[model samples]
Structures are given as C-alpha cells and as structure tokens.
Target: MNTRSTSTFGHVALIVAHCAGMVDLVALPVWVGTLIQHYRLDPQQAGGLVTLFLIGAVLSSVFLASRFQRVKGRWVAAGGYAIAATCFGVLSQPLDVTTMAVLHAAGGLAAGAALSATHGTIARSANPHLKFAIVGVGLGVFAVLFLGTSPKAIAAAGGYMLFAIFGGVMLLAALVCAIGFPDPEREATDRQGAPVAAIPRAVWFGILGISAMALVQSMTFSFLERVGNDRGFSLNAITGVLVVLGFVNLLPAALAAFFEKRWSARSVLMVGPVLQALLAATIMMAPGFYAYAAAASVFAAVMIFTHTFAFGLMARLEPSGRAMAATPAMLMVGAAIGPVLGGTLVKTAGYGSLGLAALLIGSLAVLCMSRLPGHAPSSLAQEPA
Candidate 1:
C-alpha cells in the first residue's frame, strides 16, 4: 500500500485500540463491585483489584515502553488485549476471591502493555499537540457510553455475562489492531525511532503543570458520579452529565489543534489549572446536578487543553516519536497515584476534601506553567515527535 493508505489504516487501528481501552475501563467498576459482593470481600480487598490494574499500567509505562525497542506496536497491543480477554473470561468462572484477584492482576499486566502500545501508535501517526485530546476524546466517547449505560444492562441481564461480552469485544478489538495497524515507525527509521529523554529542564515546569492538571481532573472523574448520586440526581441526569462532559472534553483539544498555529504550547497549558480550581470550588459550594455538570464540562475542557500543550512540549523535547510518546506513561503514573491520595483525603476529611485537594493540585500546576521556557512560535500542529 501507499504511504497515505498505510497512514490511514494505522490511524483507524489506533482509534480502534483506544476505543477498546474505553470498553475495558468502563467494565471495571462493575466487575469490581461484583467481586466484592460475590466473595464477601472488604472494601480494601476489592480496592486491591483496581490497584493492581493501575500498578500494571504504571509498570508497563516505566519498564516496558521505556526499555523495550524491538517489539512491533501492532503485536504488543493485540497480544495484550488477547491476554486481558482471556484473563477476564477465566475470572468470570466460579472461583475463590484469591483466584479472581490473580486473574485480575494478569489482565492488568496485559492492559499495561496494551495501553503503552496504543499511545505509541497514536503518537507516531498523529501530530503531538493533538495526541492526548484526540485519544482522550476517543476514550471519553466510549467510556461515557459504556460507563454511562452498561451498568443497567448488566444489572438486567446478569453481571457474569457482561464479562463474556467484554471479552468478546476485546477479541474483536485485538483482531482489528493485529490486521490493520502497522509498525509505529517505518522500518527504516529504527535508528531514529522517536528518540526521547526525560523532558528537558526547560520544560520541567510544563511537565509538572500537565501532571497536576491530570491529578485534579482524575480526582473529579473518580468521584463525581458518587457525588451526583448523593445530590439526589436521577440516573438520567447522571448520564447527561457524563455525556456532556465527554463532549466538553473534546472542545479544548480541537481548539488547541486549530490554534496551535498561533498559540505557544506553554500558553495553552497555562490556562488549565485556574479553570479547574474555579470549577471545583463551585461544585463544592453549589453541589447541584446542573452546577456539577457544568463544572465537569469546563474542567474536562481545561484538562484537555493542558494535556495537549504539555504533551506537545514533550514531543518537542524528544524528537524520537517513541521517546516523546512515553509522556503518557509518565502521566499514567500520576493518574494512578492521584486516586489513592484523593481517597485518603476524602476518608479523613469528608467529601469536601475534594475541593481543597483540587485547589492545591491546580495551584501547583499553575505555578509550574508560569515557569516553563517558551517555545518559538510556529503553525505546525504536530510537535517534532
């Protein structure tokens, strides 16, 4: 096939892989809830399943993507999905809680590899500035759908059957990836395969900004549904909020890509934290479904903006697509860490702690953004990576 043909196929496969990730992520809370009930486990024991999944993701980013250079992107993603599906199927079987936890861990390990490979694919195929938002939108779209809709279906049909359906989805997604996605970089580019380093000192602050933005945004996402429920919001209202927020999340990304020609990446990232803090504070004070939904929309937009900018900077710092792509891995680590910290804060201080924590994290990010070195102005939507 021609270059355009190859790029098209690659893009399609990458998007498919991203969509599959959303399916897996959305299905998790349901599965975890089932495990807790089925095994008569404590919250801590059930929580360990999520922890293992995240740990697997973090480890894959740091260890698998960072060090391994020989593996092809297509196979890594497909293989991981296959493994995850197989594990989930086994987990659905009648088993002890300990056995189920082991299966969950194995699935998580596969998901880690799948996650990194998907990032590498998207980074290689698209421009850096748009990578996160584009991927975020794809993820948010299906996530909103599944997380928003699937729980009721599972409740009506039977929870165990959901795992089988999810496993089938994984198999379909993996097959699509294996057959369609090409190598991340053409074979000839091996010597220069997206070389990246720890982001440069000049951009350290920008990195911090993105990380902080992710922390706050993730905290909101983790708890907002519960908060909405507490506020007596109906299921439809909750679903509306998620759908709206998902749509809102794409706006900043689309705007950033459209204006990257005019705006410095630093300038774009610098706008996220304050927006997040204001919205978070508003939610704390108002706590209505409408107010909370509006807050979520704006927060998602700003977070997308900050993420795209910082990822763009990372790509600029590491021209090697592969190396620059690892920024997602790093962000994944921060994301994994944020929820645990947030849970602790909420447990000790009550739900109101979410507002305070958001303020702190957002403030730290703003401070970091203020100190980042400026890049030369350019119209190029894609960063060097």
Candidate 2:
C-alpha cells in the first residue's frame, strides 16, 4: 500500500485495538458487579480479580516496551489480541475462582502487549497527541455502545455473556490489526548501530503523574455501580448514568486536541488530578442520586483529557517511542493497585474512605506534574534517537 493508505489503515487499526484492549474502562462496573452479584464474591474479592488482571498487564507492558524496536509491532499486536481472545472465551465457561483469576491475569498480559504495540506506533506518528486523541474519540464511541448494551445482555443471558462479548471484540481487533497494523519508521539510532538516548527524567514524572490519576480513576470507577446500588438507586438508573458517562467521554479527547497548542500541557496535567479528586469525592460522598450521577459522568473525562497531553509530552521527550511504548505500564501499574485498594477501603471504612483516598492520591499526581520540565530539553531534542 502507498504511505497515505497505509497510515489510514493503521489509524483505524489503532482505534479498534484501543477500544478492545481498554475494555476495562467501560466494563469494570459491570465486571465487578457481576462477580459480586452472580458469583457471590464480596467487594474485596471482586476487586482483587480486577487487580490481578491489571497487575498482569503492567508486567507484560513493562517487559515488551523496552523491546519495541526489536520486535515486529504488527505481529505483537495481532498475536497478543488473538491470545487474549482465547483467554476471555475460556473465562466464559463455569470455573472456580482460582481458575478464573488465572485466566484474567493471562488475558491481561495478552491485551497489554497488544496495547504496547498500539501506543508505540502512535508515538511515532506525525502528531502523537492528535493521533492519540483521535483514538481516544474512537474509544469513547465504543464505550457508548458497550455500556449501553452489555449490561442488558448480561442481564438476559447471564454474566458469562459478558466474557463472550469481550472475547468477540478482541477477536475482531486481532483480525483487523493483523491485516493493517502499520510499521513505524525506525529512528536514526535504530537504523544505525548507535544507542538510543535515555528517556528524560521529565518523561518519567509525566508517566507517574498520569498513572496516579489513573489509580484514582479506576479506584472510583470500579465501584461506581455498587456505590449507586448501595445508595438504593435502581439498576436502570445506574446504567443510564453509565451511558451518559460514555457520552460525556466523547468530548474530552476532542477538546484536548483543540487545546493542545492553546493550553499549557503542564497546567492541564496539574489541574486534572485536582478535578478528578473533587469529582471522585462527590461521587463517593454525595447523598443525592443526581449529585452522584453528575460526578460519575464527568470523572473519566479528566483522565482522558490529561492523558492525551501527557502522551504527547512524553512522545516529545523521548522521540524513540520507548517511553510511550510503556503506555500500558504507565496506565495499569496504578490501575493495578486501584480496584483492590478501593475495595479494601470500602470493606473496612465504607465508601467515604474512597473520597479521602482520591484526595491523597490526587495530591501526589499534582506533585508529579509539578516536577516536569516546562518543555522537552533542547539537548534531548537534538540528540540522535
């Protein structure tokens, strides 16, 4: 294919891969709820299952990210999703908790590898921020469809259907990526025999900042449905809130794209965690249904918006794409801690403790953001690879 045609196809593949691989963002509520309601697990156990999945993702991403240039992105993206599909399919079968936990971890490993390939390719694109935002928009649309339909499907056919749906989506992504995942142009350091420059310290801070925000996001989001349910909201009402949340999700990435130049990325990064903490606090502590629903709906937007900027910044900081290749590690490391931590807080201290936790974590995120340099250093920019 011509370069233009190849780039177009790759973009589409990335979008699909993102939606499939980040299914946790949309499915966590139903996922945790199903384990609690159907499998009769407590909140802590349900959250622990999700935590195992994220921990596996973190491990896989960290391992593969460093090898990004050596490995073939297309093969990794396709094979990972293919394996993840099988794992999810097997998870649909009736199994003991131990078996199910193992499957979740395995599936997460596969999915995380695929996502590492996806983000690495995007980082090498002409405009990483714009490309990432475009993919984020695609994820938002997928979230709308998944959130709107999956709950009802699970209700009708049992919780097993949720895993079936997840398997199907991963299978489809695998097929598309196999056909069209584009090869990124190698950096000069790779083309020659020279070593790539080390990732900047600022980039590490950006990654940590984004991860902290993600921790707050998953910690609160994983329990969104249960919080409402415990507060006596009807199933339809909570589902409706989720659907609205998906729609709200549609705007943040686009807005981030528009503001990429107009707004300071560092400022956005700092403000994001504060907004997230406030929203989470409201979601956790609000007594009225409307108040809780309002906060829950906009919560994801904060992470999406901030992460878009952070992704772009890291791409600039490390032109070789290794930093961005660790996208799954940056995202899932903190995410790995969130569900279990949230569950522990809830199990011991009630939902109000989640609000307190968000405040503390958000403050840490802000501190990390504060440590970032205002821009990528000139020496790093001029350095080969």
Candidate 3:
C-alpha cells in the first residue's frame, strides 16, 4: 500500500477504535436498572456486574498488548467484536444472575482486545494527540446519542433484546475491522519494515497518571445518580443533566486542541485534575438542578479536555506503541477498582464522598503527571524559540 492508503487505513482504524471505545459492550447503569428489576439484585450487586465486565477487559487488554504484533491484527480486532457479539447473543437469552455475570465478563474480555488494538493504531498515528482528541469527541458523541436513545429502548425492548441489539452493533464493527486493519502477513512486513520508535522515560508516568484518572472518574460516575438524589435532585433531573453532558462532551477535542499548543501539555495535565476535583465539589455544593446543570456542563468539557491530553501524552511517550497498547489496560484496571472504592466511600462518607474521592484521586494523578515535561517550564512567555 502507498502512503495515502496506509494513512487512510490508519484513520479508519482510529474511527473504529473510537467506536469500540464508545460501545458499552457491558452496559453500565442502563443495565443496572434492568438487572435490578429482573434479577432481584441489590444496587451494589448490579454495580458489581458492571465491574466484572471491566475486570475481564483489563485482563484481556494486558494479554493482547504483549502479542500485538505476533498475531493478525485484523483477526484479533475482528475476532474481539465477534466474541463480544457472541456473548451479547447469549446474554440476550433468559438466564440466572450467576450466568449473566459470567457472560458479561466474557464480553468484557472481548471488548478489551478490540480497544487495545484501536488505541494502538491511534498511538502510532503521526499526530497522536490530535487523533486522541478526535477519538474522544467521537466517543462523546456516540455516548450522548446512545445514552439519549438507549433509555427509551431499554424501557421498550428490555435488557435481553438490547443485548442482542448491541451484538448486532459488534457484528457491524467486525465487518469494519476486516477492512481497517491490515492482514497478518502485511502487518508482519510493516512491523519489520517500519520499526516503532524508542520509549521516553516520561511515558511511564503518563501511564500511571491515566490509570489514576480513570479510577477517579469511574468511582464517582457509577454512582452519580444516587449522589444527586441524595442531594435532593429528582431522577428525571439527573437524567437531564447527563443528556446535557453528552451534548457538551463534544467540546473537548476542539477546546483541548486549541489550547494544547498555547498552554503546554504539562500545565494542562496538572490543572486538569484540580478542575475535575472542583467540579465534584460543585456537585456537592449545588443542591439546585440549574446550578448542578451549570457545573455538569463545565465538568464534561474539562474532563474531556483532560482525557484528551492524558491519552495523547501516553501515545507520544513512546513511538514503540507499548505505552499506547497498555493504555486501555490501565484504564480498565482503574475502572474495575473504582466501583469497589466508590461503593465503600459512598457508604462510609455519604453523598459528598465523590468530591472527597476526586480531590484525593486527582491529587494522586497530579503527582504522577508532574514528572512529565511542561509541568514546570519557566513560562510560555519565557520559552526559547
């Protein structure tokens, strides 16, 4: 293939990765309500089912990251979709709670393989940061649209049918994967012909920072609705706030990209967590819906902006794609642990636990990020040309 063809393929892979990331192969809160209603699970049990999915994803991501070049990239990615599709197909059947958890865990493992492949493609891109931001925007758009539509569909079709529908979505992704990724032999030649670059020391810190960031976000996100209700907001109001967040989530790519050159990645990485913690505080302080709405909008924008830099920085940390390969694994690892922590904190600390958790977690993230470049540069004004 020529340069243009390779670039086109890479772009398609990025979009596919974005979609793979967006596809909730496991269905979180949406499935939470269904699991609770149908399976007679308590809130924590339903949430644990979500964590099971992440646990599987984390495990698979680690496994795939090591053998990324050894196998057929196309088949690995396509097969992951196929596997998730099969899991979803089985899940659509009537089953006991134990069976359902087992099936969801299977699906999560499949999703993680595809996610690692897709993120690897992004990491290998020429402009990884920009690509990462675009991927985030794509995910945000898809999440909003899916979240907006899925609730009603879950209401109408119920959980089993919805799982089947997602299975169909994965099947479509498999078709795209066939076209996007190179065949095994071609991939082997490319890997041998064009070697991946050396890794920077800073990449390791970026990895730790991204993982911690995920823990902070998921810890609160999984239980955000309960927190809102505890603060006196109605369920309908909280749903409305999320929908608005979906819309505003589109801002990250454009906003973050605009500032990335001017602001320097280091300072953005440091301050991003602080802003996230502040947003958590806003949710705690603002009891009224409108105030919460204001906070949520800004929060969505800031969170996306931060995530763009985090993923992009990791991609840039190593041209060898090792850092990027590990990206999804770290993310899922944090996500897997988040619910456990959130469950514990919400129980012990009350509605304000998310704020406290974010504060503490964000501080940890900040500390991890400080080791990277741009954090303590003299000033944007003082930099040499």
Q: What is the lDDT of residue 16 in candidate 2?
A: 96
Runs of candidate 3 with Cα error greater than 4 angstroms are 1-13, 24-34, 37-39, 182-199, 229-235, 298-300, 375-385
What lDDT does candidate 2 reach at residue 75?
A: 88
Q: Report lDDT (CA) for all predictions.
A: 0.62, 0.88, 0.69
Q: What is the TM-score of each predicted model, taking all chains together?
A: 0.82, 0.96, 0.85
lDDT (tens digit, per residue) of candidate 1 on 1-385: 1133245666667766776654433444344444444455543455455556566666665566654356677788899888988987886667776777677667766767776777655545435556555666666566566656655665566656656766776787688888986664422244555443443565556656776776675555555555666678876776676666666654666776777668876676666788877787666556566777788656556766666666666555544455544544455455555555555655577668878888888888878888764563344223333
Instruction: Please give the range of 10 consecutive residues that has the lowest summed lDDT in model 2.
Output: 376-385
How do the residues 158-186 of candidate 2 rate in per-residue lDDT, one tens digit apiece?
98998999999999999999999887744
Worst lDDT 10-window in candidate 3: 376-385
Give the Cα-based TM-score of candidate 3 against the true structure: 0.85
Global CA lDDT computed for model 3: 0.69
Full-model lDDT, candidate 1? 0.62
Q: Rank the candidates by TM-score, best first.
A: 2, 3, 1
Model 3 Cα RMSD, Å? 4.7
